[model samples]
Target: MKGLFLDAVDELAAVFRHVARPGDPPMDVIERGEIRPEELPGLIAGYDFILDDHTALPTEAMRACAGLKHVIFLGTGARSYMNPEELADLGITVHTIKGYGDTAVAEHTIALMWAAARGLACMDAGMREGMWLRTEGVELTGKTIGLLGFGGIAAEVARIASGSGMRVLAWNRSPKAAPGVTFVDLDTLLAESHVLSVHLLLNDETRGFLSAERLAKLRPGAILVNTARAALVDKTAMLDALRSGHLRHAALDVFLTEPLPAGHVLTTLPNVTLSAHSAFRTPEASEKLLRMALDIACGL
Candidate 1:
């Protein structure tokens, strides 16, 4: 089968080579800095499968690609890139890999939580400019951290937080159990947590789940961390809370808009720490993602 890797930026060529065996499939890379919907068709015309990292495959483009039957997305956020049901109607099955970067993302989430609580980013910037700044950071020990969803990444977060002597609490749409973790109702979790981390998937039911009213229910001076999709939270409400000091700080790895645009309001906020949606970006996760993609393609 013929495969095309669209938007293969960040030195992923070696990963594809490592995962793909000779004679299994012929793959080509189009290393464009950015991909628009208009350029997708010509770039992936004759390929039977397309591997997309962040390119959006709209319904119109998928319908135009007659030879395309499969799309192997790099991560589980395919819905953010393309509508899976719409692509399936056009004979393209979108495949996503989960749990490949669970530990990688969980570790990054913990790092961001620590950074936000301690004002590490701002202090580091001041020190680099030859100014000594000492900021008092909140203690994590004996504090309550609430997980919004209990998935693989959340489980890993719970493990780490519990090990650090922080109390772990979680709320899920369905029931779940982990040793020493408390499962509470949504309202209870919101009012009681010192740190709240979002781990829910983005879908029709969960988009904007953290609305303005819900944001108001959070404990005063609470720290919020989101390593999940940005759509899960109301962007305007979150910004307002951060600016009003209702929320002490936010460590965000995802945004409503990817690349976040230059000079966005979130960029100017002193209380917000932003990552370029790179929580899942580790060498080990990259290898696992490539291997899983190759396995899916080979199975097909």
Candidate 2:
């Protein structure tokens, strides 16, 4: 099967060339930026498979790509870009790479947690605007941190946090075992943690899983670190929580909209720190992810 590395944005295209090898399938790179949902069918026609990094593939639009049968998503959260089950009905088997960037994302999550706790971003922004902002920050050591899910990334986070002397608490939909981590009930985890790091995947059941009611359950003044999909938390409720000081701060790597619009409300919030959906971006992780996508295409 021929494959197209759809939407080869510079960053991904750069690393993709570095990892692609001689034995790989005939995969063409579309040296364009992100493809919109409406452009999917037109741009993807003629390709039997696509190794997509961050393009939308709506079932309705994708139906127009008559010959396409496979989509090897470069990362785990393909659901944020399209419905795999719906695509499956169209004879398109969506494949995702797992464990490719666990350490990269885990390190980003830990970095966000520390930055939020210490108000680093806020201070940096203030200083850049000619203001000397000196704000007291949260001390993380010996504090309880809650992990909303137990996955490969969370396991790495548990390892790092545990090593740093912070009590790690986790709650997953299924049972899990990790060293130096305490598994707790959702409510217990919510009420006890001083810092809550989100790690749940985005899906029908998980969209806005951290709703207003659930957000209300968090320990007062808790810090929130979200490197996971943005829809996992109720965006509006998160804003209110940050404004009211119910949440001490929120450090996010993902947003409901990519390239979060300039002058967006979140950008204006002093208590929020933002990173361009780059939590899983590291040289090692990018190489592994692209290599894995190539492996899936080769198999197909």
Candidate 3:
């Protein structure tokens, strides 16, 4: 089937070419920056399927594309950009790739956890501004880290944290087991964990899962690391927790808005560490992701 790689930035375009095989389905890559939802119909006119990377595909806009049958989202968080159920009603199937960047994202989760625990970003910014900032750092060796969801990414995170001598606790919606990890109920996980890392998928059931009441259950002074979706936690509640120092710190990779606006409240917070949702941008992960996307297209 003819396909288009919609919204492939230059870096992604390069990776796509690197992983393309000779016998693969015909696919064209559109090397451009972000496109508006209104531009969707024109760009995907004759494509049977499209490989989407961080683009918004409104059902209304997609309705105009008559021949499109499938959308192979480059990552698992397709719900952040489009309503899969709505698209399905339009006769379009949405496919998501998993485990492509598990290691990359897991390593990033650990890095953010450490950075927040140690106040690294605050000190770094202070140093850049001609001040010698020496902040007390948390020693993670004996800390307890709770994984909110047990998935491939969280499994890798549990392994790393366990190797570092940290106690690992996980709570998943369904039953799951992993070595060196203790499976606990949500309340126990919240009350005992010194560090809490969110790894849940964003969906109707899980959106704003960490509400004000739930955030209140966290151990006072606990650090939070989220490489998962932003909507998973209540934004106002998180801000209140951070501002009130109920939460020791928060390290975030995703946000309610992309390109988090200049002078945003989050940017102004000293207890917060922010990354541009780049936990899965490593070269190894990029190569694996594109290769897997191509593999999925072959199956389609």
**Winning candidate number (lDDT):** 3
Q: Is candidate 1 or candidate 3 better by TM-score?
A: 3
Candidate 3 lDDT over residue span 226-268, tens digit each = 9999999999999999999999999999999997999999999
After superposing candidate 1 on the true structure, give the runs of residues whose Cα lies further than 4 Å from its correct spot: none
lDDT of 1: 0.91
Clashes of 2: 0
RMSD, each candidate, Å?
1.2, 1.1, 0.8
> Which is the leading candidate under TM-score?
3
- Model 2 residue 23 CA deviation (Å) reads 1.5
**Model 3, stretches more than 4 Å misplaced?**
none
Q: Which pairs clash in the backbone of model 1?
A: none
**Whole-model lDDT values for every prediction:** 0.91, 0.91, 0.95
Lowest summed lDDT across 10 adjacent residues in model 3 is found at 28-37
Candidate 1 lDDT over residue span 78-133, tens digit each: 99999999999888999999999999999999999999999998788789999998
TM-score per model over all chains: 0.97, 0.97, 0.99
Residue 135 lDDT (model 3): 91
Worst 10 contiguous positions by lDDT, candidate 2: 33-42
Looking at model 3, residue 142 earns an lDDT score of 91
